[model samples]
Target chain A: MKRLWGPASLLAILLVVALMGSLALGEVRLAPSEVLSVLMGRGSDLARTVVLDFRLPRALVGIAVGASLAASGVLMQSFFRNPLASPGLLGVSTGGALGAVAALALGWTANSIFALPLASISGAFLATFAVMALAKREASAEHLLLAGVALNALFGAATSFLLNLTAGRFEVSGQIIFWMLGGLENRTWSHVWMALPGTVLGCMMLLPLGRSMNLLSLGEQGAQSLGVNVRRLQWEIIILSTVLTALATAVGGVIGFVGLVVPHILRLAIGPDHRRLLPLSMIGGAAFVLVCDLITRFLPGELRLGVVTALIGGPFFLWMLRRPS
Target chain B: MIRTERINLGTRLRDVSLHLLKGSLTAVVGPNGAGKSTLLQVLAGLLKAEGAIAWMGDDLNSISFPERGRRLAWVGQDLHADFAFSVRDVVAQGRHAFGDDDEFIDSAMKALDIENLADRSVTRLSGGERRRVFLARALATNAPIHLWDEPTANLDVRHGLDVLQLATKLRNEGRAVLISLHDLRAALCFDQVLVLDRGHLAAAGNPDDVLTPELIHRVFGVKARMGQEMILELP
Candidate 1:
């Protein structure tokens, strides 16, 4: 059937508009033609730096982060096969948060821009392995989610305890606050250089598996009979998704809603075909995060990034969750 | 063709010998909870059974997934249609293992009389229609070896008979079709028969000699009476 957006294509359009919105509707606005001129590299050096150097990286990073989070969300939802499944709820973002918080506390991230992502990737991988081990032997959706909850609570409490201990002693109060809230602020070409490669590579790995995942949606036994090696497939996706969530968090700091909410909305629009669903979410996720980031920059008063995302996402997520089964 | 030797892997299948020739109709019949389904899955290599399941002297597991798709097809009990895919999509998925086989898919759908329901969503189909679609998918594989688990379940008398008749036709066309049946009356039409009870082979061979009233009573806890036309029925 010909669809309105087919979820995937609709998200692609939204991503372009959002990218334009980020470039044109910033604190200092620019015209669409000016943005296009800058995009095409024909604009003056001042416009070029202002557009390409300042806004382009921000917009591109938002898309990268958004796509990463959305892709992570799809993996979690498919692995658990639950609409409510999100990287945040499953403690994956929490792992990234803990990793960032740890690097800040240990004074390891001060020397290089790379330390944050490196530490965060390590933390996320550790959390993933711990949960996998805890739920191994007889793992199902419920058991995996439960393990995620336990890890989330434990890591959350530990992160808070560390913050409380360093509230005065470390003199890193601002860093702690930023670590918790999540942002795309002051993100430069260096951060992009570090994160974009892994994010793109991860997507490449995941895209091929989309058709295989379509088979998996029929349940593990169904995939197995169709010749899918279930355990290997599960582990591969988990590892790939973990890396994406970690790198995004490492680069952009725990951006919420994009990963958790985008896929559910897309699924409702397009019947689940991962070949279509995965790429669609990539574009949709980028648009959603970029819009939220732009809105946060001029929200009347000083607004925390996580608070802005939460204010918008919390209500929408609850509504989606409460929709009749 | 499909071939298996005295391929017993130790103690699991001492009495689990099966010799299904090409173009023969075979039915494994028993009451509920019998190992009939298990045997079908094992022979189809969906399970890791002790006995060997060889297709033309190639170890079953050694064959690639797509290769097996061209040679053996299995329809398990309690099928899961978790996605909201159109019926055509579900049928088309069967040909996924056999690339570029739209001809096979069209013929398979025709065989099961599901051509009319091609565009209908699988989740919306009635039980009988769903069975036919699944059967069509199996046939779409164009496999030499076909295994079906209670293909007649939930089907009305007519659909049940249609399922048996179609299976018979496939066998006549030189496909090794193994069906697990709860209906003994249908088994009377199959060339070879095996009855299972509590994971053991209760009886095997031609329906006349192996499907006696005493054996039926012992395995099913019910009396079987040979009526006017050698009908196997409960008293």
Candidate 2:
């Protein structure tokens, strides 16, 4: 219990500070107290609009998306027993992108905001399930990764095809490309509402799976002998992780690496007990993305969120691989 | 008791019948590709076969996964600790069906003389130490039946003997223990032995009766002696 307190408190403090920093250090540059006053419902209209209407939802959505992706990453790594496994690398997020793009291309969003998210969720599910089925049929970790690679290409190509089809409609094509690049700029409370339920549900579902996931890390036969229904558990993890990743993608385009890097770092610091790893990665991921978003907002140009994550994550991953384990 | 009738698993294993009894340790011996591991898997209910396998009198298939887990503990030939977890953590996994109890994990580690290594990362342990950790996991399960596939492989003499002695202890405790082995001498000490050849049950019965020199030559295709201690000459 005491062991949890130190890291847990540290992450909580980091998250609060990042949240405050994101709220206070944007274009208007308000103080922490000013942001707090607005959050407590007593600030001027401009302060309320900037802090509550704008930055607060953006930061909250970033936290939710970060937490979701990180949680998904933990699940993927444990499910595959490979530290490198993640929704982004596996084409799951790409599948979600294709879904959102398809919804936009078909003008479904004009009907309702819900249509795009529902489509993205289904798309994520299909991609994840396809990869899982391939993994099962192949029965090799390396092969599963290969399947992910192929699926990623297929999804990317499909997304490209959709973009090409929408080229005549500048508005639709712009939306598609921007979503594919992935960002959280100009996001609103509605986006927070869109992602929060799935993230919460996914975390709740993934939390209990920690023990089963821990057992699974021992290898399939070992886990089965301990009474785990490996196939069923895999399906559960696939559904939850896909849904979470899809929701995040729907709200924030295709933010990468929060899932990949946050869990890997936390595993190194805290060890591989998913019981602790799952929840801690959530807090760490929220802090990580909030900080990353802060960095992106301060940059000279309009850099995409996924680009920043890949820049930071790719090198961190390389350094990790170079480090002696 | 575990009894299988005409169990077949595609071409890898065919027409295999077995009777594994409690209060005894049964040794399964065979050459490579002879289905020794497959037989243990079928009995452990980890693999489905096109035949009836019963635990006591109930159909093994009808028994739920968790129920079977409580009844049987299995240790596979290949041991992997890909993730960094302590030796005690690996052993504690055995208690999944029964829930967390530090005492069982502690005793299991102690029995394998790994109490000192309990806090050490399993991935960092030596091959023999990792084998012991796996064996300790099976022991910690406290299941009525144990199926171990080549449990002594990669173990040194002392640790190898520890595994054999542990099998004997479990048998004495009235649990059924089935061990697949490449070690003929170790198999010779078990109460009963089942010899397999090309997925066929070549021989079965008392080890003393089944492990004849001629049978060893015919089934294993090796010149062997079964005297006070079984000795083999590889081809």
Candidate 3:
């Protein structure tokens, strides 16, 4: 228990620093003091518009997306009893990406701003349920993973078909490509409202399950002997992880690697006690995404947030795979 | 403290019924494919068998998972740790159904002589050390009925003897203990012995009466001469 405090404190400090950096280092580049004054409601209208109206919502959305993805990752890793398991392993992100792409290709976004996210969320749920339906009777981790793999392939192919159909329409194709690459650019309070509440509530629901998840590391039969209803826990893990991944992808597009990388690092830093790992991963994930988003602002080109994270996380993931556990 | 009536699990376990009393040490002995492990799993409620299993007059199936956990503790064969959880954390898992009981966890570790390895990751432990860690976890449960499958499979001779002694001690404390073992010589020390052959209960009674040379030859296909403390096999 004492070992958890150091990492917890470190993650909290990093989150605060990242939040400050995110708010202060945008195109307007306000000083820390100016940012604080604006937060305190004593700055120029332009500063308020930048910090309060624009940057604040974007930062909050970044935190929500990051935390949700990480928490979902923790749940997935625990459920599968494999460190390689991530939220996207269940095809939720691919489904969301397919939905967003289909929405754009079908000219649904011109109808309403809400069309894309709604369609994306619907796609995610459909994919997850399809995997569940295929693997429901046995409900074994291996079965679920195999089903997820099949669904991911199906969704990825559909997404590619949609992209191909829009190739002649450069504007629609470009929009599809940008959304697939993921970003927090031009995010508003509506985005924050869409992602934050579900993220917070879902994480809170996951907190009490930490102990049960820890027992689950012993394998399904072992956990069952320890009083965990393995079937119920499996369902809960699936529902929570899918909801979190769906919400994150709905708001931020197909952000990858945050879910996979953050939990793995936190599990190594602290022991695999889910009670501590779950909350700490949430903080670490938020900090990581905020830091990554901040990098997107300072980059030379129009680099997407997802591209920067992949650039960082992909190499780290490879290094992890190469190293002996 | 356990009673089963005609428990059948596919072809793995045939209709088998037995009664276990508290404060008694019972050993389930069998040859390869005799369903010893399967019977233990059925009693542990890890596998759902046909027919009925009751503990102290309560139906095992009707009990909630948590409630059943509080009453029965099990250590299965082929237990493996894939994650880097500390030995202490793994042992503490035994107390999961009952809440954290540090004293019990510590004592369980001490009983298994693994207190020094408490902070070490179970994934890094040797096979024998991992076996002891899992045993300690089951011990930490403090359940009324204990079931162990091949509890001494990977243990050193001293640790194996220690485990048998611990089982005896648990029985002495008025808890029921059931173990599936291949060591017939060790089974001699148990108060009662159950002989299984091809998912059938061939015999159940006092160890001295059930472990006769004719029965041993019939079930194990080994011509053995039973002595006071050991069984010598003939080529």
Who wins the TM-score comparison?
3
Q: Is the docking of candidate 3 incorrect, acceptable, medium or high quality?
A: medium
Q: Report the error of model 2 at residue B90, Å.
A: 1.1
lDDT per residue (tens digit) for residues A95-214 in model 2: 888899999998999998788777887888788788878878425667777888999999999989988889889998988888777788888878888888768878997898888889
Sort all candidates by DockQ, best to worst: 2, 3, 1
TM-score of each: 0.86, 0.94, 0.95
Error of 3 at A213 (Å): 1.1
Lowest-scoring 10 consecutive residues by lDDT in candidate 3 chain B? B226-235
Model 1, B38-152: lDDT tens digits are 7776777666666577776788878876676667777776555545667776666676565535757788888778888888877678877887887777777777888888898
Please provide, for model 3 over B3-99, each residue's C-alpha lDDT reduced to its tens digit, 9 standing for 90 to 100.
9999998888888999999899999999999999889888988888899999878999789999877898888886667678999989989988887
Q: Which stretch of 10 consecutive residues in model 1 chain A shows the poorest summed lDDT?
A: A1-10
Among residues 3 or more apart in sequence or in different chains, the pairs in candidate 1 whose N, CA or C atoms overlap within 3 Å are: A8-A280
- The full ranking of all candidates by TM-score, starting with the best, is 3, 2, 1
The parts of candidate 1 lying over 4 Å away from their true place are A1-10, A40-53, A76-84, A88-90, A135-146, A167-174, A224-232, A301-325, B1-15, B126-129, B227-235
lDDT of 3 by residue, A7-56 (tens): 88989999999999989997798888988999898998888899988889
Winning model by lDDT: 3
The per-prediction CA RMSD against the true structure, in angstroms, equals: 4.0, 3.0, 2.7
Report the lDDT tens digits of candidate 2 across residue range B1-235. Answer: 8988999988878898888887989999999999988888878877777999998789986888777768889988777676898888899999887765655788899889999998899889998899889888888889988999998889877777887888899999998899999988778789999998988899999988989899999987889853584443212
* Maximum-DockQ candidate: 2
TM-score of chain B of each: 0.89, 0.93, 0.95
